[model samples]
Target: MSETQNFIILGGSGAGLGVAHSFLKHIEPELRKLGKKYHLYIIDSSSHFFWNTGSPRSVVSAALLPAEKLFAPIADGFKSYDSSLYTVIHGTAVSWDVGGRTVTVELANDQNTQTTLPYYALVLATGTRTPSPATSLHGDHTITKAAIEDLNKKFASAVSVIVSGGGPTGVEVAGEAGHFLNGSAGWFSSRPSNPKAKVTLVTNRDKLLPVLSKPRALTAEIYLNQVGVDVVYNVSVVSSTTDADGKTTVHLSNGEQWTADVYIPAWGITPNSSYAPADLKNDQGYIKTNHATLRAEAAGPRVYVAGDVGDYSRGGFHNLYATIPVIVANIKRDLLEAATSSDGSDSQPNEPDRLFTPNNSETQAVPIGPRGVGAVNGWGLPSFLIWLVKGRDYMIRNVSATVNGNMV
Candidate 1:
């Protein structure tokens, strides 16, 4: 047998986990056949995978969904695997030397230092980050839980709240908060009533979902209204500041200013690709990935990419899921074919059967205050169907399956 092949997967979220688990599941047997040994390393700053799909509702009212339901130990997903097969590192990848096949990881420790690891294959899947701390889970799920709890406390007795961005996160949050503050019942009616509370959503785009056509996009705005969420369009947030008193003030593109007790920004996502090499990145700092093979051309041998951090697709769950197998396959094939290479060098892996084509069609299921709206392949989905499929429990029940790689 040859030296143990080390596979380093940076980012332990949905896309990263999928790549790691799927690779771990199938690679060992294939490597054994090739007289090779391998080990997988999963790296991330967070120990748990926060089921952020449920954040809109979860943030509004914990009574509707408990904090425990939104987070699960990521390491536990691989409990069935032998401990010798993989190692889970709680840390952040700060940099990587593609030429050296080493990644610099800033460990989640009290000491202020970083560690490096040698790898045969490096998978970049750190995903993206929202500007506002309240909008996304970073560091750890526990810290995110605390932020949500604090946000709820600030808005509990408030009369008004403003959410920036008309994207799914903003739209959904506005709808959920609107329903609760206005005393509308969702999963539970035990939420304390504050019928006078106003929830508003301000979007820079002319339409709610700019990705979809007029009539289809109008569905989101219409549903938001039904839930008492005031939708404001064609507006950009100039600046937002919070006072020491916990009140927030926002300046809009229309030269209008609005002050609210709570301000939530879900405007945009910045790809978490700081550690990726500049030559492998696009204009937006997102790693430039081969659409079909999911390989990073300039990153040299065995560097693959998956999920939002990559520039191959417009960033979505389906695209991420589709890219996983291509990455894993290319990695396996590269290793198999490169066994005889003098030095670690790119084989220019192109697995025809594992090619991934990004789906350009607009497809999404967006929940609005317990009910929902969605469109797939130019066809609108019924609210009840959206409710039945995704809105009911925000698919929290599938968190286990998702983490365990069953859904991948």
Candidate 2:
């Protein structure tokens, strides 16, 4: 074994960068103490780490959170670290082979470079990709930014807006639209004094926030009702057409047609797992990950999975924190074992200290307008608390720390 090693983190969004930050911030010093070195590479489709948690709010009004705040340069975030320590690849992984310990990346520019990178360890954090309007998990973020701007413009002119998909994103977007456009976020707005935004959230489920309990879901629906946002249940957006006038006619499953100024669909997700090994994924295309180790064992050694792309647990905000630490610990443990060994081979530890056992309990927060609903470990939290936790700011303030590796 050489004195140096290479680590590749695919998907520079939340989970990908989080692993990079965690590994570097926590492991670099330990490696240095042993005179060992490693180079980290972060690859992603976007050059920026979008603070997507604030998307619902950013979509409503850019003044609240400017693009500068929403999109942080991924390269600059790691500038403080040594120049040779890591490289940020602004590209997408087109294919990877765990058996060969190599991944192929297609560059994101006109030159169209395809590079095959070898790594001592590989972390798959590509996450899921939703359609155009729902940009949170979209791979091409520049397109997402532009699409969102167009959406905001359409939303500004359209008094009647349709938010298709009753999931967290759809409901939250509807909430933000209703909260701000109708009343300027209860603060200030350059929008017309009385924008009177008519926002409707459509879902195939019977109630809003299907993740929440029936009673908790009722609270969300009640809040939307109080804010004048209509909730259409058990209905799906079958198809949509936009005319030259920018008016969208949405066709529903029930043969109902509605014309709205804006149509935003937050449903339908395609896991960005195409580049991953076939054996790593489940029937749904999400990577099948070990809950205890966060590794796709079929991918062979030092290959782990994290965040929404993995099927170990439901992808949630806190789940990233829960899962990445286990991955980092396992990585760190392996690195430490090799560093301390007489020969460069892993000295496996017996303890399960690095494992994380996923459970059926829920920990999620969905804010609607100003009020919200949340639960942690099956216990419901108060609406105001949920609002305080996310609605007030959408955790925009934490994006920098998250990108820079402080909050993993």
Compare the candidates by lDDT and give the number of the best one. Answer: 1
Q: What are the lDDT figures for the candidates, one per model? A: 0.80, 0.80
How does residue 295 of candidate 1 score in lDDT? 81
Q: Write the per-residue lDDT of candidate 2 for residues 165-205, one digit (tens) a residue.
A: 87788888888877766753333422334547677899998
Query: How many steric overlaps does candidate 2 have?
Result: 1
Worst 10 residues of 1 by lDDT: 185-194
Runs of candidate 1 with Cα error greater than 4 angstroms are 183-194, 339-353
RMSD of 2: 3.5
On a 0 to 1 TM-score scale, where does candidate 2 land against the true structure? 0.92
Model 1 scores a TM of 0.93
For residues 289-369, write the lDDT of model 1, one tens digit per residue.
777878886787678888888887676666767777777777778876676456554544444437888788878878887
TM-score leader: 1
TM-score of every candidate: 0.93, 0.92
lDDT, candidate 1, equals 0.80
